[model samples]
Target: MKPIVAIGDVHGLEKWRSIVDEHEDCTIVFLGDYLDPYEYITRRQQLDNLRDIIELKKRRMDDVVLLLGNHDLHYFCDRALPGSRYDFQIERFAEAMFNANIELFQYAYQQGNRIFTHAGIQHSWFVDDFKGDLTQPIAHQLNNPESIQFNAMLRLGHARGGRIGKIGGIFWADISELTDPLHGYTQIVGHNRVDDITERCGYNDNKIIFCDCLRNGKYYYEE
Candidate 1:
């Protein structure tokens, strides 16, 4: 199997560009949070860099994947909602990301149900919950011809939390729901920034891998 390199929470593109340039053989999975909190007015440059990276990846490899995060969802909300509390820079950065057609949730799987998503999968999903292949319609819509269902799925209650039962935003549901007998998969996710290389949750079975070691325009790889 090809080695996997999952990038975490890149609000800017410079850092990712360097990493992408260096790791041509390993498939790079971008774990979302592509907008918000720009330290400088380089939104244009950063976005251009991101576009270049995407184009390069698409040309050079067949497995590059982009996983969407909650912040990415904010950009997709059509209008900025109240109490968002997101950084001011997000507005412009989000616009740029949307223009590039980046959205939430990207996945890659290899060997023994190994998968990479922006966040963890729930532990309680039964066999019935999954239509087929676990990814099913979500992946099909993305891969098929002119499908509107993919975009529609994004509007589901699970995408955004509200005054309702536990909606399981990208981070919580995807990561915590691996407790059921039918659920079995390892997912790489981003959202909560972690200074360390790895963080574990629930029993020894469930885990969330955060790759936020690099800060201030640099890519840090662990192991």
Candidate 2:
């Protein structure tokens, strides 16, 4: 993989499919949220999308990294669910995916020096939890990926029956409140909806880039 393409929330799978062809010389890091079908999408269709992605991961384990978002974590932990979602159904579908690709659905992926996750890391939590560091701590946690800790940092959030604004976990962060408290690498994330991919300077040499425009139909191709 030459250049890495970090994708935003997969409300369904259109965004994911749209960027597949762009993977010729690049690794694809899919930020999760694979369930909760959009208004026009059906549950079966959503599962099919997920199934295809899971299969892709199986085929190209090294080339594809599937990081969990709040929704994915909801099914993984089966608690603190953000209202009544398809937790049970998604769990059933994800069981096969997770079992076959256990190491794939980690909390975050660090490509080069940049960190990619479903939601951006909370500025404060990165300091508190990870001891004011980004890449190393995230990589270490992903090594184990246990349920309790992953849930606290990943799934506990706004629409998922948790508080709206706080320095939560990687998957639970609200990007708007994120600050760059670390140095070195940039953090690329999904979850928060934006019109286009935007980059902002952080406290140190770090950057925070938002990659959630697919929800609004604003793609990299559009630019």
Candidate 3:
């Protein structure tokens, strides 16, 4: 398998440029959240950060994968992301950012048996709810997300919350309720808080790794 360098939440940090530059050959799967600056940051910094990230993906198209985050979903919704407390709002520039790299921003990417996403998956959402074809790669289904049925599945499963009766479903999942290792793949996720980039949930062979560790404007990755 190609050595994977999975990065976590980066809300417009310039250090991403250096991180990508350093890992010129490794496959870098970036967990999304490339927009909606922090409360204290200026909008210019947010634009610069996203622009840098977009440019990096453009330059490293095959090596980098940009998975969509709940914040990025603001474009799909008329309102702000959940629990953002209105501190973050959508803007016109978001359209440009989304348009620039629509092909690169998938919902999931797989490296060997480990999969990456803005959040983890709820197995039920795939097998039971959507009835997605198991013969196909999940990434293929996510990338071809123009179907109305698939869009419903995306909204139900990709946003934060216990929409699945109990808990866990990519963006909204509490991580604690993931319960199982999500059939066939050990999921790597963002959208949750952790002190370190390598912090993981679950146990043994079944684990969910959290990598949204951009607390400091520095780049981080899991080898």
Candidate 4:
């Protein structure tokens, strides 16, 4: 099998450029959160970084997969929603960019029994909110607009400051909200920040790998 390189939340960092360069032959999956950098990185830098990532996708259409994270979804939303470090100044530009290349982004990706999503998927949330067919490929069901509601994917659980008893959906799920990984699939995701790449096992030993440690110089590689 070809190698797979899963990158973590970018947050306007340039380390992804090097990771991609080193793994040019591998399937590159970005776990999203392309914007909203730390205090030091300027808004312009974040915008430029996003443009570069989009360009890379254009160049390597088949090899690269971009999943949308909560940070990114705010820019695409019809109106302002809750997001950390949201910049009103770049909203128009970022929205335009995303709208133009929206086809390149997706809610999930699947290969064999492994799935990739912006935030780890929870079993309860899938059963309650996902409108897609469980028998089908998870990514296919998610990417097809006819199969799911766009707004449903944006749900935020109580852990991330939403209503009590609610579990966040794919794009907005917090690590705390995911008590167990989705049944029958090993999921790789990035959303909640971590100090290093981490893995957790749930029911039936299903695996959920968290790789949102890019700010600390880390990524997940599989062959």
Q: Which candidate tops lDDT?
A: 4
What lDDT tens digits, residue by residue, belong to model 3 across residues 59-86?
8788878888877766544433454622
Error of 1 at 193 (Å): 1.1
| Candidate 4 segments exceeding 4 Å error | 146-148
Model 4 collision count: 0
Q: Quick one: best TM-score, which candidate?
A: 4
Question: Considering TM-score, where higher is better, how would the candidates rank from best to worst?
Answer: 4, 2, 3, 1
Task: Please write out the lDDT profile of model 1 over residues 1-223, one tens digit for every residue.
Answer: 5666777777654577777778777777777666553465365665665566567556755757766655566655553242233655546665565655643235323334454545444443212222234454333422331333233223223334533433233333432333321234444556545565665554535455556544544332433
- Count of clashing residue pairs in every prediction: 12, 2, 3, 0
Q: Write the per-residue lDDT of candidate 4 for residues 95-192, one digit (tens) a residue.
A: 99999999999878899989999997887677677665668788877777552465667777899888999888888888888878888889999998
Q: Which residue pairs show backbone clashes in model 3?
A: 159-172, 160-172, 161-172
Local accuracy by lDDT, each model: 0.50, 0.67, 0.65, 0.86
Instruction: Please state the error at residue 221 of candidate 3 in Å.
Output: 4.8
Ten contiguous residues with the weakest lDDT in model 4: 143-152
Give the local distance difference test score of model 1: 0.50
The stretch of ten residues in a row with the least summed lDDT in candidate 3 is: 79-88
**Model 3 whole-model lDDT (C-alpha atoms):** 0.65
Off by over 4 Å in 3: 76-90, 146-153, 156-168, 198-205, 216-223
The 10-residue segment of model 1 with minimum total lDDT is: 148-157
Give candidate 1's TM-score. Answer: 0.64
